[model samples]
Target: RTSIPINSVDQAIGAIRTKIIFGGLVISVLAAVLGLFVSRRIARPIGQIRTWAESIARGQFQYRPSITASEEIEALSVSLSRMAEELRERIDTVIRQRNEIEAVLSSMVEGVVALDMEERLISMNQAACRMLGIRMSDMQGRSIQELVRSTMLHQFVNDTLSSRKPTEMDIPLSSDGEVIVNCHGTLLRDAGGRQIGAVVVFNDVTRLRRLENIRREFVANVSHELKTPITAIKGFVETLRDGAVKNPKDADRFLTIIDKHVARLEAIVEDLLRLSRIEQGAEQGEIERIDSRISEILRTAVQVCHVRADAKQIGIEISCPEETRAWVDPPLLEQAMVNLLDNAINYSEEGKKVRIRVTQEEGGMVISVHDQGCGIEKKHLSRLFERFYRVDKARSRQLGGTGLGLAIAKHIVQAHAGRLTVESIPGRGSIFSIHLPTNPPRNGSASHGDPLQPS
Candidate 1:
C-alpha cells in the first residue's frame, strides 16, 4: 500500500514551483514598504535642513538642524550645521552693534532722526521727538515730508536724498524758535554695491541757535541801553545851553530827565550783569529743597509795587488759597514774581486793575498775573518772554523798562523747572502764568518738575 501511494515527479515539481512563486510575491511586497520608509526618512532630513537654511538667511539664530544620516547626505548636513552656527554668530554681532548705536543716539540731548531712501522715517530717538515736540510712536515710519513741517527741512531732505551728500539747514521749527540741523545722507548698498536704499541723519542745533540769538540781542540791547543815556545827556546839555537856564524850572526839568535816563541806563547794565551771573549759575543750581512760601513771596512782590499801582490808580488784588504752595528757590521765585508784577504794572493802562492769583493746579501750582491793559497782539505773544522783545518799544522806554524783565523771568522759570506762558488778544486783556511743581524733586535731580509736563 505504501508503494502505491508514491506520486509522480512532475506533480511534486509543480507544487514546489507554486510555493516558490508565492514566496517571491510576499518578498516583493515587503521590499516596497521598506523602500517607502527609507525614502521618507531621507526626505525628512533634507526638508529640515532646507527650513533651517532659509531661517539662517533671514537672520534667525534659533534654527538648529539635526544630523542623523550616515552617507553623503551626512557630510552635507554637517556643513549646513556649521554654516548655520556661523550665520547666527554674525547676526548676533550685527544686532549688538545696532543696539549700541541706538543707545548713543537716544542719550543725546538734541534730536536725531534717520530716514530711508524711500523717504520714510527709518527711526528716531527719544531726544529727537522731544526737540521736535512730536511723539515717538507717531513719528516713526512716516514720510519725511509728512513729519517735517518746515519747507527748508523738506527741500533739504529732498536734496540730500537725491544728491546723497551732507547738508545743513536752519529750519524754523516754530515762530519763536529755530533749529540748525546738520543733515548727512548716503545711499545704502549691499555687498555687491547694489543700491538698496538711502539713510539720513538729522542732528538738531536748536539750543545753539537760541544761544546765538540771545548773544545778538544782548549786544543790541547793551548798545541801545548805552545810547539812551548819552542822548539824554546831550539833550540836557543842549537845553541848558539854549536859554532853558533863563527859566530855573525848565532847567531843573531837563536835569531831572537826564538823571532819570542815567538811572535807567545803569539799571540796564546791572540787569545784564545779573542775567549773566544767573545763566552761569544755572548749570550749577544743584537741586535743593525749596520752600513753599508762596504767600510771603506774593505779599512782598505786591508791596514793592504798591506805590506804583496807587499812582496809576490801579488796584493790586491778591486772590489765592491759604494752602497754596510750591517747591521753589525763594530768591529766584521772588525775583521772577517781581518781574511778572512789574510787567503787569508797566503794561496796564492808568485806572485799569491788575490781579495776582495763586492756586494749586493738578500736580503743580499756578501763579497768574491778569492785567486789563492794552493787550498784546497774537503774533507778538510767543516772543513776549524773549529778551529785549517789546510790544511797544517807545512805551517800554517811557516806562523805564530795560526790556529784560521777561527774559529774566523766563530764565528763572527754566531754572526752577517750570513753564511760563502768555494768553492775550488785542483790545482785550492778557494773562501771564507761571506753573511750578508742588513737590521739590528729591535727590537733587535736575528734572525738578514733573516729567509728565514739558516745559
Candidate 2:
C-alpha cells in the first residue's frame, strides 16, 4: 500500500459522506411521493363515497359514486347503491299504499269519520263534512265534541272505542226530527290487529222513514174509509129486514140512502182502480204518448166539468194558443185536466172565476189552473196531493168529493214525465201547475216534483 497523503484521504472520506447523504435524500424523496400518491388514492374514493352518501340523504337515489382505485371501495360503492335502490322501492310502495287508502275513503257515499284513541278527529270524508255541516280542513286534529254538536254521536263514538266492538245508532240531526242518520261504528285496527281508534259510517234514512210513515197512514185511511160505508150499508140492511120493509115510505127512504152510500163506495173503488192502472202503466213505461194539440185536450176537459161549473155558478175561462202542442197521452192528460177543473169548480164560491192558462216555459210547457176561492193554508199544501188528504175532511165529504182526484191527477202528470206543483196564499188564491217536460225522461225515471209551496 502506498503511503496515502492526508489531503487525498480527506477527499475520499468526504466523497463517501456526500454519496451516502445523496442516497438518503433520494430515498426520502421517493418515499414521500409514494406516500402522497397512496393517500390521494384512498382519499379520492372516500370523498366520492361521502358525496354519494350526502346525495342519498337528499333523496337523490339516482346519483352514483366513482371508485375504481380500490376493489374493496368499489365493492362498497356497489353495496351502497343497491341499498339506496331498495330504500327507494320501499318508499315508493309506502306512498302508493297511502294514495290508495285516500282514494277509497274519498269515493264513499256514506259519511265516514276516523278518530284517534284520544277521540281526536284524524280524518273525515266529503260526505261526513256535508252531513255534519263542518269543514274538513278546519276539523282535523280537533276533539270529536268540538266538531259534532250531537250528544248521540259523541256517545256513539265513545261507546265504540270503549267497547272495542261494532255498534249502531240512529241519530236525529235536524231540530224538527226530519233528518235521521243511521250510524255504524267499528274499531279501527292496525295490521298487527292492535286497536288504534274508531271509525263511524253514517247513512241518511230520513226518506226511508217518511215513506214508511206514509205507508202506515195509507193503510189506516183505507180501512177507515171502507168501514164507514160498510157499516152504513149493514145498518140499513138490518133496518129493512126488521120492520122498514113492511112500510113502503120508510123502506123507500132507507133504500135511497143506502143507494147513495153504495154509489159513493163504487166511485171510490173506481177511482182507486184508475189510480192503480195509471201507476202501473207509468212504472212499466206502457203509457201511450202522441203529439196532440194541447188546446183540444183542455177543451175536452172543460166540457167534462161544465155541468159542475154551472151548478157552482163558477165561470170558466181558457187562455191557450191553438198551435201549442206537446207529447202526451191524450186520454190520460184529459183526465188530469178534468180532475183539476172539477176541483177548481167545487172549491170556488158562487160567481167565482176559474181560469186555465197554457204557456211555453224553459225546458218544458206549463198548464196552470188559477182558482179564485178559499186558498189552501201553507201547512196543508205539502200533503194535498197525497191520497185521501183533505184540508177540510167534513167539507170534502159533504161535497160528495171522493178525495182521490188530486192524487189521480198527480200520477197522470208524473206518467208523462211531468211535475205537479201548487202555490197558494191563505186568503188570496191558489195556482196548480202541471209542468210537462218537452223531452220526457226514460220510463220509470220520472222526476219527483219539488215540494209544494205557498206564496
**Among all candidates shown, the one with the greatest lDDT:** 2
After best superposition, candidate 2 residue 419: deviation in angstroms? Answer: 1.3
Q: For model 1, which pairs clash?
A: 111-128
lDDT for each of the candidates?
A: 0.77, 0.88
Which ranges of candidate 2 are over 4 A from the true structure?
1-40, 54-58, 66-69, 439-455
TM-score of each: 0.64, 0.86
Candidate 1 lDDT by residue in tens digits, 1-455: 45543467678888999999999999999999999999988988888878877887787757676668758888888888787787778878998999999999888765666666777877777876765667777866688678667777677767776774556555666665654665556666679977655655556766777788878986887787788789879988887998998898998898898888778878888888878776766677663435455777788888888888888998988898655656777777788888988888887889988888887788888899999878888889867877788889898887888888988988888777788998987877888899888776654743333223222
Name the weakest run of 10 consecutive residues (lDDT summed) in model 1. 446-455
Query: Which residue ranges in model 1 land beyond 4 Å of their true spot?
Result: 1-181, 187-198, 206-211, 231-255, 286-296, 320-332, 413-416, 436-455
Ten contiguous residues with the weakest lDDT in model 2: 446-455
